[model samples]
Target: MTAALAVRNLGRDHGGGQAPALDGLNLDVPAGSCLALVGPSGSGKTTALRLVAGLEVPDRGDVLLDGRSVVALPPERRGVSMVFQRPLLFPHLDVLDNVAFSARVAGASRRAARAAAAPFLDLVQMGGYTTRRPGQLSGGQEQRVALARALAARPRVLLLDEAFTGLDVALREDMHELLHQLRAVLEPTVVLVTHDHAEAAALADSVAVLSGGRLLQHGDAGRIYTRPASVTVSRLLGGRNEVPGVVVGGEHRSALGRLRLPTDVAVPDGPAVLLVRQEAVVVTGPDAPGADAAGTVLAVRAAGARRALTVEVVSPGGAAVQVHAETSPGQVFTRGERVGLRLPSSAVSAVPPEDAGTEEPEIADRRTADAGRMPRTHRVASPAVPDAGVRPDAPGAPRRRNHHGDHGT
Candidate 1:
């Protein structure tokens, strides 16, 4: 049966540095639900998964399944199964034997084990290839076999560590659909570790964003994307349009201009950031329907259905800033073209920069020439974000439609 999984105060250190692989990670995955632990490299995503799978021991905290601690249990005894990035199928064994390995270990007869494996193989669409070895299978086919084998064990909790990363986009989409099928029929609690926010959003019921080995934000995909706790979480979720500003008198005054705070967002008068998705930033002709912030188009790149444009704007309080906007591909916007940008109050989020010092937080760059690189990693995990600055449940800001498909969260 599916079971609730709770990770309480989980901590881990691999030595050689102050930054632990995972630090004080607290998470809960309801029965038959999925939670994606999304983060950049070295952000403790896999380490947390290992700790949960009994492959690695935690330095502190407890792992509870259905309100019972299983710290002392072995991996085989924990009633958990993990699928790694690679299939890791036994090279010598045929698909049938590979899937029946778990049942064989349980002292079942070969026929009984194969009988138990057939349904899972059919579940992952590998039933026809029962006699084929791992070497004969394609990357996607091997992953299907691996998944079937994992399911053959009938674990209560399933952990996937970037299992679909190696597949092409189309194959990944196929695997995603297969996972949905598996979850619906098997009903196992799932924890997915991924670096792609879009993957997390598409698969998981909830997302727990991690950075520097710390829990930055955790909630439904829409809420986490729209209302990130800090600049760090925003960057992780591909929030490129960040305006440095301060909130005083219930309004955010920044280079983008003054914006009245949404009712769901409550922060004291202090340094803050105005985060508007590129899709939310409406771009119009310079003179038509003037907006709060006006800018000149610095560059434009056509990306099929949508065009990504970088606009340069300057205000008295701030230096020239590049605001990225996504527009229809059919619209022709050239460099040096004057444009007006309207950041709808209902579509923007006001969050703390969390930078008390002069140095601005390293924002993730997803636009312009030097775009798509991950931010620099911290030597140690960042401290937990304070509750006062976090407004996780902000229903006031309407969820913006994502035009980027799998490219966005």
Candidate 2:
């Protein structure tokens, strides 16, 4: 079961703070699709989730499901359910009873609820564990049962608050697969709160970015990742290189050289910030064909199957820029080795230096697939998840005015 969700002017104040924990948040989740709320800690991702779940009251705003306001409804009557980070299963109850708890609350007999919950338990692959107590199940098993419990209730909208955060990498991947399966078959409307960019990219049809209790940007998952609305949003999505530049016509030029702006994006003439995703940059031997810049390796660190490097690039005019990049784990570069860089035009985005709050969130909601409109499942990819960095609030850094000798590496 699924229903569209609308959040209008949602505001919550924890008090004693400079800003409300959640302020004027607006989002729309298409029936049977998923939206992810992403940001740093205290960005109101969880606060928004709680408000929508009716677990907490909003200081202002209205929550509408399928166009009907549910503000007066208690949590139990809201036709929604939440799955928390921890399984928090009842230690004494067996798996089957745990999943049937909601039905039991609704006045169903134990035998009737258990029988009704059998299929949901099977859906999560825990049917055989019905007699096992929560304490006897593994962490992953407990979560699976928890998910079953939430599903057995037939919620019109499901809220997941870091439900997979505590799981190990392998277990998280397993849960992601299960969720994909559930969405494909059940098509429940969902709002997920998580700090994990990769998780959001993998699961959400759309992404809503928030910071300082204000909505920063929201849009299609791909748009949010490839073309962030501001430098803050780009950094949140893990875009590393912020090349200060000027846009003349549609082209952007920085000290490093030129970056072809996306044709679909109309960048105003004058100062702009060219966003180069860290993964979009490919390092090669100095003087390699199509090399955009030359740089000398400053540092390198290998972690598991990925290698990270800090490189300092020098221009012909003696300007220097530090860039961060990643390469295959097996590829090795010495600290002093010189390298060439290639930044694909398609991977670059341009945003005005202003970096203000988001435009109407309708742009995000407008892109959502209409109710009963089946969307593709399991779509997931992004430019590398680079290290987070501070926002470059101001733009138009120094640039080279004149060219001299050969371009320096």
Candidate 3:
């Protein structure tokens, strides 16, 4: 299958004491499928969209639409339409006229443009508000109208840059449903840029994760979420319980105790990082049999349907590890109480350690360049594992025990 859109070796530089906005970024969007560009602020999500839209020229590489290069083509010439974070509607035009404007620009008569835009307005569920002006409509309603307008151009590719960022949770969900329904009917290739993982998971068939203008990983959303290519990608996708450990033989040894490696995961025998999902760590009574390790509860916070606990576990060598776990609402545990924790081998995977010498400096440079462009609050911070102080093994310290009975040599 040929790609509907292709970005090959894309590079962009802002210059003037700033690092490149995008460097060596590449991605592909299959025809009639949705691909989401997700990452922290200043990760070049918007820059990638703009390069494909012809709003900005790339310093290197090319943007291709259906195997044809469009890097030098103007935005109007490319068969692409972009929706920004805010609705860029014409103030003087009513919702109907705004939706019809694109058709009219393409030389359709006023009557013909309105006729062409009517079905799209209905597609977005904005048919009833056709006579309202942009100022009179709510944010969600305006966005709906903006979407209808974009469709009026009959674009082969639709680009959305944080298009739903301003709406409330309920409205954002409604828009997601609308987009899904519209995609079923129109089947246009879509590229969405968002910081919300839920939005990406809900709308995208595939996700491309970026960090510091570089593509970290790109694959099916389910695979990316469950088996991220690196610790950085795992963190971006909300894999929170990262433990520093080492791989010996075919098992992993960490503060949580030794765990057997699954056959599918292949990692070199050396220093590694174990990525564990919060739901995978089972917390039980301290005396529970078959427990992997024992830890003291440091904090418990109520999440929506479950509660999150911060547990501090100690290794035999006195190294301290802090991990997060989630439990049901019915289960209650207090701080300072001892609890038994189990790290299931099935839910754990190992990846090579992050090479700080190369990636960190580029990330810092991108952050500096994006300081003024994006609000500080909008930037997604790199995930950090809370550290528990390392101390000498006290008298009667808990002995190392492998509940799985798979201790590594």
Candidate 4:
């Protein structure tokens, strides 16, 4: 099947000695499927979305829609619709008028536009709020209308730029469910840009990871989370237990202990990194016979349904490895208690070091010492929409600008 959208060698350079916002980027979104772009700020997620939306032309490469080149097409003529972080609804228009705005722009009469938009508003659970103006609606309500507006346009492709950001957890989850239900009904090709990994995993069939203006890896959510291509990707996907180790035969020798490598992982006999999910580290008393490693509990904290334990284990070579383990709520352990850790071999995978000589013993020792106080996750303020490196009045295209920076991905 042909891809609904194809970005081929897309590149964009923001002049004045700044790095290229996007470099040699390429991606394909299969027809009727949702693909998410996730990465850190200034990683070119918005730049890529703008290029596909025809809001910014790429400095190099072409965009294809339905197997046809759309490089010369304008955003309005490309059969695409984009929803920004803010609703961007017209203040003068009520929810119904705002949703019908797209249909009206496409040449439908006002009566016909409202009639066409009714189903979409209802589709997003905003039928009762049709008469309410944007100012009268809550943030979530306004966003629902925004989605209704985008869908009412009858777009063949829908682009969502962190459309769910800034909402409370409960509302955000509601929107996710709404998005999935709408996708099943409308079947439009979707490309979502998000900084939230959980949102991407929940909404997209596949995810493409970007960093430093480059594509690192692209695969299904499960594969991307479990078998990331690099340490950067692993960390971005929330892999907190990264242990530097060496491949010995088919097993990996790490500071935690020796673990059998997954049969599918093909790494040469050399230094590598072992990624273990925090949930996989089973904790038991020191006397547990099958424990592969033993550690002293530095701290234990209750986190909702699970208990989290910080452990410091010494390898046979005397190198220290700090690991975090989660156990059932019923199990309790005190600080300074000895515990045995079972690092399941099946839950471990080997990846090459991000750089040569970056996994030395000294580095591991330092990390082990510092791991106790590190935050569970790191977060940065989302970046603003990056400049496309193209002038607003570049020939036939009129200048358009969004001040909010890119919201998510």
Worst 10 residues of 2 by lDDT: 383-392
On a 0 to 100 scale, what is the lDDT of residue 261 in model 4?
83
Candidate 1 lDDT tens digits, 1-409:
8889999999998688777878899998999999998866667887787788777789999999999998777677788888866676767789998888777777788899999999999999888999998899999999998888777878889988778887888999999999998888888999987766678888999999887778888998767777777767777777777888899978998767778888888778998888887777888888767487788898787755888888998888667778999886577788899998887766688877765462223333232324632233222221111011111122221122222211101
lDDT agreement of model 1 with the native: 0.76
Please state the error at residue 208 of candidate 3 in Å: 1.3
The residue ranges of model 3 lying beyond 4 angstroms of the native Cα positions read 1-3, 279-291, 329-331, 340-346, 355-409
Q: Is candidate 1 or candidate 3 better by lDDT?
A: 3
| Candidate 3 lDDT by residue in tens digits, 7-44 | 99999997896878899987888899999998777778
CA displacement after TM-score superposition, residue 368 of candidate 3 (Å) = 18
Q: Looking at model 1, report the run of 10 residues with the lowest lDDT sum.
A: 383-392
Q: After superposition, how far is residue 16 of candidate 1 from its true place, in Å?
A: 4.4
Measured against the true structure, the TM-scores of the candidates, in listed sequence, are 0.84, 0.84, 0.83, 0.86
Compared with the true structure, what per-residue lDDT tens digits does model 4 show for residues 1-409?
2248998999999889888899999888889999999876668887888888788788998899988988798777677778777776766778898787766666678899899999999999999988898789999998898888878777788888778886788999999999999988888999988878778988999999887678989998766777788777776665677788899897888787788888877789999998877777889989898898899998887766888888999977889988888886688889999999887765678888887454434234435644664443323333332111212233322223344533332
As a whole number from 0 to 100, the lDDT of residue 369 in candidate 2 is 24
